[model samples]
Target: MNVTITTIYDELRGFLDDHQVSTNETILEQHSKDESYHTPSLPDIVVFPETPEQVSAIVKVADKYNTPIVPFGIGSSLEGHVIPYDKGISIDFSLMNKVLEVREKDFLVKVQPGVTRNQLNKELKKYGLFFTVDPGADATLGGMAATNASGTTSVKYGVMRDQVRNLEVVLPDGEIMHTGNLAQKSSSGYNLNSLIVGSEGTLGCITELTLRVYGIPEHIAAARAAFPTVDDAVEAVVSILQAGIPIARVELVDEHSITQVNRFSETDYKEKPTLFLEFHGNEQGLNHDIEFTKEIVEDHGCKEVHFEEDNAARNKLWEARHNLAYAYMHLNPGKKHMVTDVCVPITELAGAIKFARKRIEELGLLGGILGHVGDGNYHTSLMIDMDDPEEMKRAAQFNEEIVEYALERGGTCTGEHGVGIGKMKYQQREHGKAFSVMEKIKLALDPNEIMNPNKLVHSKRRSL
Candidate 1:
């Protein structure tokens, strides 16, 4: 390594202990990429910081060297959001993990950025509260906030950005700033919390957060409804939501996905297009919702609807849904996993998914369709053999076609997964003139383009 970069290693060691800084090849490889199929790139060094002050110090040093700073938080992101394409300092936040406080009366919790959603929920269980922005993976809260992640429960509980009430962020120039306060609502200055939540580490580094939580519901019921076709299942979601059932989670898993899930989880779920449903409410209310949902699905051509009466069964049902992607990965051992996230208007969802399914068949690719249909968001989890150039090209074409289709309508290229390297090309097409505004924000906040460069917005410092 060059002398200048080598000096950064020494400076980082000075900020923390010697053990906190790593030039080890294994650690560098681990920090190189996330769960995406995007190509991996290594950072020059990885430094573990335990406090916001330490994070600020690391940022200052990165700024001094004009080096890129990619924040690491378990590296569970699927869009290559944390890859360090421009070899520099990677700030690993695993050591900063801690649940600082749980205010049960206030229904809020203060936690360090490294704390995962599962970890926080575990602690909140003692207080009969739960953090609800579950994006399938046990991803670190910091990473989830960076990506504005959402999954099955987003239809009711909302995304990570919604739960976030405050953030302790370290700016590109090493200044510590709080985006919001603990108040229930705010009409103050700009909604910096919203801006930073989905910034994908381009604007600032989140060191700590104050998040909103919900009390455990008195009654919970989960069910799996089988449909003859994917269209029927998606249409049923629209109907259920339009009926105002307050469904906690409604997911559409296609026949192919169910096959993979059954193979991986060893559960006989009747290999067919199905809708995984859940409702949270009082006993009487939940019963009414379930009955109402059953009527709506039957009207839309549901073949069979089965409810999980026990907690174990309910957990297993959701577990299979959450592990659906891994199921694809497991069954197709040699191929990489790439998912297309597109969300459309509720009315347009059925048609959009139909188009995606058609394209998948036309392209002759190996993949499955899954949707958080309650919110009109779905993903096509594709398995591709990277070595096969023709197959890779077809997969790329499929992604582009579906993304363009979503853009042509009022939908986004990415519903939940942030535009990392994977979806960066679609930004201009999706945002039009407003994409320039995003660029200006990136330039203003990160003039040197040091914070998680080459992922989100592209500035003059780097080309997309």
Candidate 2:
């Protein structure tokens, strides 16, 4: 017995506002998919909840109906975490966007789940404070927390989990709970806050987040260093880290990505394996750091190093880096992008990149390699036509081989993107005996398997 939109609407009508529930095909179709390459399954309905109470009520109703509930942010997830694969309700929190409080004195900000990093930064600019975990997209704070996302800045500031101090969650049984306090750190039993930060909405819906903020640095400088080989760039990053240079951002872009960036951003940068880097500190400190970094990079065979001091030029440089994925999409119009993320130990990063590059070339795929090198994590963005089964197969094979390589080298299959549908097969391989423990936790939190069902875990559907 398949659950229908009419059934859900009838059950939720009394508890929600008239306009909050949507059954329109256009809206449902729009919410059905994310930025990933996974196949989409249209949800029976979409609902926008504005408050924790309302979200709890919605969860209760869905639980009663045994309908899967997926928490949706901006749908910027690269792992298909936001896609409604089993056909349920996509609870969109866009309307709940609100920055409730900014405690400058304590260096923390409390915000509603729908608040995005860009949006929060706009507000924090007045206080000379900023949040640093940027995942390329202006993704919602809730989504970032769901995926434990990190990007270029994560090399210095850490990922979403690092910034999140507390979470107000609505559990599957409609119970509201606070995961942590506003304190800086704690020895408290069981770090539930850490557990829920990357739960991917299978455990609960995040209604509010208490995030740590940072004061804007007095000095900032951006630099681009081109290398003769990708291995040289990776080795340079490792040397920089080992030398204890406080790099604010260290991103690796292979020759393929530089080519796409050149075509898309209309900038004539050398098409070579490069590291787009940045540093933030006092002027004197940054100067010394940059000088030391330059020396280390030169020793590693750096071909050219260009530094940008002006704010506008620096922003433009990063803008090009952020647009690399979009550029690949534009270059391969009418095709889907398949990105595989894997992280290895710093010493092994160069070897891993070399192997992946050889494999990608052997498979004959149009893709580029890029990532936050400071963290020893990288992603290969493959442009594949969904209509071509052969292309999809080759992409999957490439992803599997790279993940296997990483796992064998004591690394994770995914560094930032959560295990949605794309990386589910590797969970067992990566977690080993611990994977069973994860399933037990899932069963305990969501016995009915109604919260984002068939995601992050493999389980059989209970008969109604």
TM-score of each: 0.98, 0.98
Per-residue alpha-carbon lDDT of candidate 1 for residues 1-464, written as tens digits (9 for 90 to 100): 78988898888877689779998999999999999888899999999999999989999999999999999999989889989988898999999899999999999999999999899999999999999988888999999999999998999999988999999999999999999999999899999999999999999999999999999999999999999887788878878878988999999888888999999999998888899988998999888988898899999898799998589999999999999888999888999998889888877887887888889999999999999888889899999999999999999999999888888889999999989888899888889999999989999889999998888877555675
Which portions of model 1 show Cα errors greater than 4 Å? none
Could you tell me how far off, in angstroms, the CA of residue 241 lies in candidate 2 after the best superposition? Answer: 1.0
Model 2: lDDT to the true structure: 0.91
Clashing pairs in 1: none
Model 2 TM-score? 0.98
lDDT of 2 by residue, 1-464 (tens): 24465777887888888889998889998898898888888888899998999999999988888888999999989888988877778999999999999999999999999998899999999999999998888999999999999988888899999998999999999999999999999998899999998889999999999999999999999999999998899889988988998898999999988999999999999999999999999999999998999999999999799999899999999999999989999988998888889998877888888888888999988889997889989999899989988988888899999999999999999999989878888998999999999999999999988888777888576311
Per-candidate local distance difference test: 0.91, 0.91
lDDT of 1 at 226: 94
